[model samples]
Target chain A: MATAPQLPTTRPLWARSPFYFNSTAHLLRIGRGKANNLQELLEALRLCPDSSIFRHTFQTLEEHHFIKEGFSNDFSHWAFAACNEVELAERLAIIDVREFTSIATLRDRLVLIIEEYLQKNPRAATRTAMEPFYLMDSDLVVVPTPYVARNLEEFADGLHKISIHSIYYHFIDARLRLKLNNNDFSIWLEKELDLAQAADRINRIDIYTSTLEGVRQNILKIIEIELATPDSAGPD
Target chain B: MKDKNPDRKTAVEEKNAEKNSKARDPKQQQEPATPAGQAAPQELAVPAAPSGTRERRFRQTDLPARVIERRKHPRISMEQPLPPAPPCLDDYVSIIGQPELDEIRFLARRLRGKTVKMVNSTAVGGGVAEILNRLIPLMNELEVPTRWDVITGGNDFYEVTKGFHNALHGGEYNLTQQIKDIFMSYSEQTRQRMEFTEDLFIIHDPQPVGLVHSKSQERGKWIWRCHMDLSNAHQGVWDFLKPMIEQYDAAVFSAPAFACQLPIPQYLFYPSIDPLSEKNRELPEEYINKVCDDFGIDRSRPVITQISRFDRLKDPVGVIEAYKLVKKYVDCQLVLAGGGATDDPEGAVVLQEVIEAAGDDPDVIILNLPPWSALEINALQRASTVIVQKSLKEGFGLTVTEGLWKEKPVVAGAVGGIPMQIIHKLTGVLVHSVEGCAYQIRYLLTHPEFATQLGKNGKEHAKENFLITVNLKRWLVLFQILLGMAKPNATI
Candidate 1:
């Protein structure tokens, strides 16, 4: 096999700035927008606040972090559980949140998916849900934790020590908040440490297939492998 | 961009200019500006006398006979000094880790100066009183300055409110004008007697809900905490209470289904139990055995338990019916342990029915424990093989949370807040009927390994979501939002 070029271990000064670990606790409030049928749901999605879009999609990962089965978002869950719309539910469930950055785009995608489904099955538009879907939004109360990492060794240690909530905040939530295609950890690793290969490896981690704890274990494994590289320095 | 409504924009500009001119005056500048949507403290028409001064005025020799007659009721009792809190913030660090504790402290720091006052119908019985008793002390320990007040009323008042409670839980009530008058009369007396000095007032349940009539923008924000299931509330009772409920700055419900479509923003708050409290604290094997012996519950045989008040809503008769069905398949004993709340006048009647339903069944035991029998209840729960909470209509079903916290397989009714706690065979099994409850009990008794796993998952679920620490965090966050310290919908 041909040998790949060795990457440099040294990093720029900006990349060495410590990553402060933060976590969020949400204060959930019921939004004014509610829907009883598919047509009404489409209207509510069009007019509902961006935070509601964030809540049903991105925040659902944290809320239902334990469940390994079923649809990922509340909309799909409601569609299947309440409306008995299996085909539409599956379609909505497949709209992966990772594809979009801004909540506006995510909302548009949801609207588009529902619209397309309604076009295909016109009767589905008039089908009433067993229970009304009440739109809810959460206010994120972010608090910095004691864990901070200035280097890869400390980053692995911090990841091991921090709560699963912190992991969700940095890995999943930061994607929408930062309006970037990548998560906070990947962004920092590539921007500051000049570790684009390592960042890309992390960015490729399948978030949908695993729990938050599972994600943490995978990240720790990757960091351990990186730390074993010949030129990699131990914690500074 | 140019203003779309030029005249309206100009009028707003002129008003702002006038306000600014007034602000430029030295006298106007000397006074602190009240935030928009908030009234100045002085604008409260009620006298802001210290409680002691108010008491002194009541003792004046020249007081009128009408005043003295009105004082006979003494509706609002001052906050009784609490005993020392058993589980401080540091104590919870063992159950929930240090990071969770630190987060609670951080949220509390934002609400350091604000005062919280919790008002309910009773001071010693029921879930609301028990939570307030522990919560107030712990919040004060966190330096949040919390107090609790119990509103006292005559027996007629309680009877009427009990009817209101049942009606709110979707039971039928006549809801006559007499009932309305009794509710408002007691509420008015409570309003007159109590001092509304706290920065935040939490009016719990419908009994004290009418006190929102005293809400002034100059005073602190008022929140109506509806701890009942109002999804199918009687329209007449709801209409009577709607205006007062709408007057609140916000409303909080135990579950999403418990909320009505009110104009004010509604938040979902799950009621919690104190792990360090006698009702939930870990008990020794010897103590558990003694409790079982005391109740005549056979330890060798599988013991199923349900702990709740002797209220009709709890469905103790339904529990007995389920136990009889399970008895056919398994040689198990059922322990139905509970006491009565002071405000629930119908408990005695329901207790009679439960006793009759369980008549002469050697395998079934019913213990009418007192309110202070926390240790005994904890031991009984710890000794049980499985726990069940078969409520026909429930208010959050704290008993189910208590059972799950003890790491016991729980079979609860899929109503109110019970479903939120029991995640349908994931944490614990949620049953809809006596037959389903019996079926699950028999299944769990037969499948020991799966039962143990459910128990373990149930404990983890309770630890994560239903512990007192999480409830404290929710309150602190709500305080932050109401006090303008944090935005209601802001993201990190």
Candidate 2:
């Protein structure tokens, strides 16, 4: 028997561990997990081609397979399929960066990526093409036991407290504080993001000493704000 | 050989000798025979006017009737049609990419409600004029309400300004009191004769740098946009002009290094090309072929051409040296075609020198055309197998951008904004010397594949960076920033 799904208590709603779990579960129920490798998974998903996101991934995976094949003298149909895949991959790969390795990294990367994608692709909101999912609600479980009504008001109060705790880390200051002990990685992210943001702020960047220091301070302020957010919020 | 036909051979030899002697010194008169047919004694005679003055006359007036009839057809000049007054920016930006569109909108907001009037000497025949002719319309399309005005002057004023130009470019010039007075007198006359609105006024180049004094308290946003390389300008000239320049709200230069330590804020804006313009737009193979045929340039042999004003800074003479070096490896011809600007007095003398240096070489064609010769320049560039711009000093050579847009690989001097356009060995080859230019030309001629690659990359780069659409977008954003309608965005 399969184990029940569990939600992490310390992340934001969008960054929670259960989000991708729910999405993959839907794909698994649809027989997508029968795929033995990334290539197979891409091909299987391509059969239905549910969302533009899925379509983009399928195309990239197909190109990865072709490059690995190294120009085999296959039939025209096979060659053309690879050609189409490579073309699509080339177009989408322009936006691809390093993949996330940890759940926290994934949460951060996904939110940023989705926000940028939405900004660029406003029409995507109108398209009802993205996949949806249903999470398992264990509270609905029917157990063979007598119901006990003990401290109902106390239960509601605890519920409210837990809700606030779940969201406290979402603020930038909270993330900075949590990652303070991991200074190198936090500093690296802060520096990179500050540079990118500052670059987008000015018409032309002055590479003077003052401007460089100003960029550093600007990003550090964002980190400070992250660190000061109430613990009731979730991770950034 | 069996004894030469004595009478026939001597007759031919005598005729050849006469022809050679006449050609040898056409500037001298033929020796007159004495009355008694005796060898005339060499007489110490008074110098007479040049005998070839008749030959030196402009030949355009002496064309045959048929040729004259052809002229009646009303030839299309560089000024013809004027590119249909450029379409509104809305139609252009709508199809442009988002980043580019946003850039235009941002610029539009900054420049909104501002009327910028750019005044330059000579509305044609020079780089500054050619650029303004295109730039002004585009600025207006962005709703900046820009206008271009040309200052008129007589020969004395032009001669003085030409000295000023050379002096500002570090040439050893004595900016005497007479020259200063002459320049000032012309400026004062222009100020009195012309109408200037109380808007953002820009005076371009040293020719009109003194126009700042004409500005009144009501005048807004006075900018002196200098296009010449002033890094090593004569201190005397700069000192004379400094006080008037500081009166402006800001100064604009093509390069940061060209900016002086003026009290006013300095903005560095590189000149750009309009890709959609006739001079730059892609021409079909048939049209390119026709242009070459029409120009009397044979496409069979490699054609190396330099299209620039007859100014010495462009170094048309150096271009010849580079072409000669390349010609040693491959059979090619050189074409130097350009005209004089109204404000540039040295162009005529320099053009005469260029022609003399070129000699009677059939491969060297020097066309001293009028200012309105854009199509001919376009045809020559399109027909060129290799285009070179060997400038001793330049303020962003637009010819490089023009050649690149046409997908013709250029070998240009790595000065000013040239490097900004030609990525060495990529979009085009940027050389520092005539020898380097020659070597690059030879390489491109030898490696057809590399030439094609460079041309393609250059075309794409021009489309992305220097199109009229991009220029208009920049103006719009600049206006927005100036008007306080929007803050300028820093690009990463």
Q: Among these predicted structures, which one has the highest DockQ?
A: 1
Assess the local accuracy of residue A56 in candidate 2 as a C-alpha lDDT between 0 and 100. Answer: 25
**CAPRI verdict on model 2?**
incorrect
lDDT by residue (B1-492, candidate 2, tens digit) is 111011213432345334334533435434321111223223222322222211121224333444233222212233222122333344343234433444444445545667887788874445676566566666665567776667778999998888888888888987789988998898888788666774678788877777777777764667787887887888998998898889987666765556567776565456777553446534455655554543455677788888888888899988888878887898887878776632355876677667666654556666655444555567678888788988987777888888887788899987777766775565788787889989999999888888877887677667655666755544443333444454321100
Model 1 Cα shift for residue A22 (angstroms):
1.6
TM-score of each: 0.78, 0.53
Across residues A186-224, which tens digit of lDDT does each residue of candidate 2 receive? 333334322232223321221121222232344334434
CA error at residue A115 for candidate 2, angstroms? 42
Over 4 Å off in model 1, which ranges? Answer: A1-8, A12-14, A32-47, A79-95, A108-133, B1-85, B152-197, B213-219, B234-237, B298-301, B309-313, B320-331, B340-362
Candidate 1's clash total is 1
The TM-score between candidate 2 and the true structure equals 0.53
**Alpha-carbon RMSD to native, per candidate:** 17.1, 25.8
